[model samples]
Target: MGNLKLFIGVLVAIFIIIFLLLIFLVYKNSNMKKNISFLYTKNIELFKANNELTKDKADLNRQLNGNDDVFSELRLALELDSVVNSLNESGDGRKIGMDKKLEGKFVKSIPNGVPLNFKGITDNYGIRIHPISKVEKFHQGIDLRASVGTPLYATANGVVEYSGMTSSGYGYLVIISHNFGFETRYAHMQNKQVVRAGEFIKKGDLIGYSGNTGYSTGPHLHYEVRFLSRTLDPINFMKFNNIFYDERKVPWQALVKAIDDF
Candidate 1:
């Protein structure tokens, strides 16, 4: 009887040890699975954050490109303005100081568009012998000679200030104030039609016809560009992308296409 009791006690002890070992293995496996799950969740969050960062980088690049394009256009406009201003004042021996106050204001006002309808240049801006007076004088504008009835158009959007003859050598002058310190004048017109003072004129809108007037010796149009009362050369302004004559319209498109291709 004593031996059987001892054997039964040993058997009970072995079974308890086995059961405890099984329970420990089960707990360890469950803990390992929980750790793996946490690692997977962490990895997923990191991936999502990385994707968002990539998208933000792309968007920032696009904005930077857009800003660059705007800056390029602004720089071109400023350069053209400076060249025209210098040419108009050249040979006069009078140095006109840079108009800092008018720079920002004028640049914001002139919109991009073609200014005139006639092609070819008869005269450039500088000191030249006056065709009519035969005296050395400063030419403040450029001459565009066309047919007597060729339509003269506004270069930019503005309100007309004067549309009549002036003794200052402008036969039939049309002055348009574009505000922001920029104004334009069309002189030596054969006739004035479809425009008047205080009338709102857009770029390419007909203001008059080109002709010999205002001390001109031949059939030509005198076009003057001004900024803050200072006369600027019309030639430099004509080099801008917005300025064009009838034949120049197609050439402008071709130039733009070439630039795009490049």
Candidate 2:
């Protein structure tokens, strides 16, 4: 009887040990799974953050390269006080303010280079003797003397408002409407069969050939700058430090030489 009792006690002890071992293994496996799950979640978050930072860096690079949109530049120039202060120091402070105000009155106005190549004034704005009429009259535009068939380009981006011959004076006329109450007219074109009405044109796009068309007496371009039908002196706008010829200038040999220097 004593031996049987001792054997039973040993068997119970072994069973208890085995059960405790099984319980410990189950707890350890659960904790390992929880740690692995936490590591995976953390890794995913880190990857997402890295991608966002890379995208932000790319955007900053584009802005530095001046590839930002025009509106963005204007907004930045307006919001940043440093830009305003610099323009003021450069003597263009008043002009910048005026430009902003005029933007509302007139259509969109952007710098479109120079009206003519740098050259001596042949016939300046104001009163001048008409080449064809041979009578002294108010010259609304300036004339640049160029060889026949010289390439003519638009001063700015605009839509063709009118493209036809005028019996009053202009021949082979091409009028571009730069929205904001501004329009430009090119007359005495040699041939403008390439451009049509209602076509979209960009600044510096070739529009026609220089010629002595309409009532013109010589191979030159009659360029006019008008504000809501009122003609303004084109020279006032061309008096910039850096100037280049557009469709409005006569493209004289002397003008071409001067432009090369510019």
Candidate 3:
């Protein structure tokens, strides 16, 4: 009978130990789940913070690019203004500094001076990427950086062949026909031109005002020099201090003969 009682006691002890082990396992599982939930919440918070940082970085970059464009425009304006003021003060009325020998010759009709008072050329005559379109193409003329309402002058004596707006990207355009198969084109002028088509004009006469018209990215004057209907670099003709002619491109000998015979 005692052995039977001892066996019952042993069974009771085993049951108690198993019950305590089950309780411990349940507590451990609950703790593990709580830890996993906490880690998941933390990961979500970190992901959201990363997204906010990315957005802030993009905004900063955009602001910097905008400021750069504004700074470039301001610098161009300052340079143009300084040169224009100096030229205006040096000359009598609209007579710019020109070579004295070619003052009364047919060579005088050559557009050998800058049409606008700009210290630098932004876009030269060649292949370049269009600012707005972002496509590589040929630029047929030089771009003189100027602000809106800046004054524009004729580069030489000529008759206005055409002066008005156009379907082309030149905006308000002006084409002048000069002697010796020479022509000058001015583009991106503000609204209507000061001169009309078929009107006679001297080298120093006012043509129009600068503007950001047509396909331009900003305000500037697009100047072109053409010989025999072929486009030439406008910068080669913009020698204000001396007489310059490209003998390779222009038949100066034949032109001089024609002028001398006339």
Largest lDDT belongs to which candidate? 3
Tell me, by TM-score, which candidate is best. Answer: 3
Q: Give the TM-score of candidate 1.
A: 0.51
| Candidate lDDT (C-alpha), each | 0.70, 0.66, 0.77
For model 2, what is the error of residue 124's alpha carbon versus the real structure, in angstroms, after optimal superposition? 1.6
Backbone clash count for every predicted candidate, in the order shown:
0, 4, 0
| Ranked candidates, highest TM-score first | 3, 1, 2
Stretches of model 1 off by over 4 angstroms after superposition: 1-108, 111-114, 241-262
Instruction: List, residue by residue over 1-262, the lDDT tens digit for candidate 3.
Output: 9999999999999999999999999999999899999999999999999999999888767655555654344444443334323343344565444322233464357787778776467899989998878999999899999888888888888899999998899999999999878999999889866999999999889999888777888889999999999998887778533222232466544564565455
Candidate 3 local accuracy as lDDT? 0.77
Q: How many backbone overlaps does candidate 1 show?
A: 0
As a whole number from 0 to 100, the lDDT of residue 101 in candidate 3 is: 27
**TM-score of candidate 2 versus the correct structure, residues matched by position:** 0.50
lDDT of 1 by residue, 1-262 (tens): 9999999999999999999999999999999999999999999999999999999888767655555654444454445445323433436665444433333333334533335566778888889988878899999888887878788778777899999878888888889997455688888887655688999977778888887778878888888887678876676566653443312212333333332333
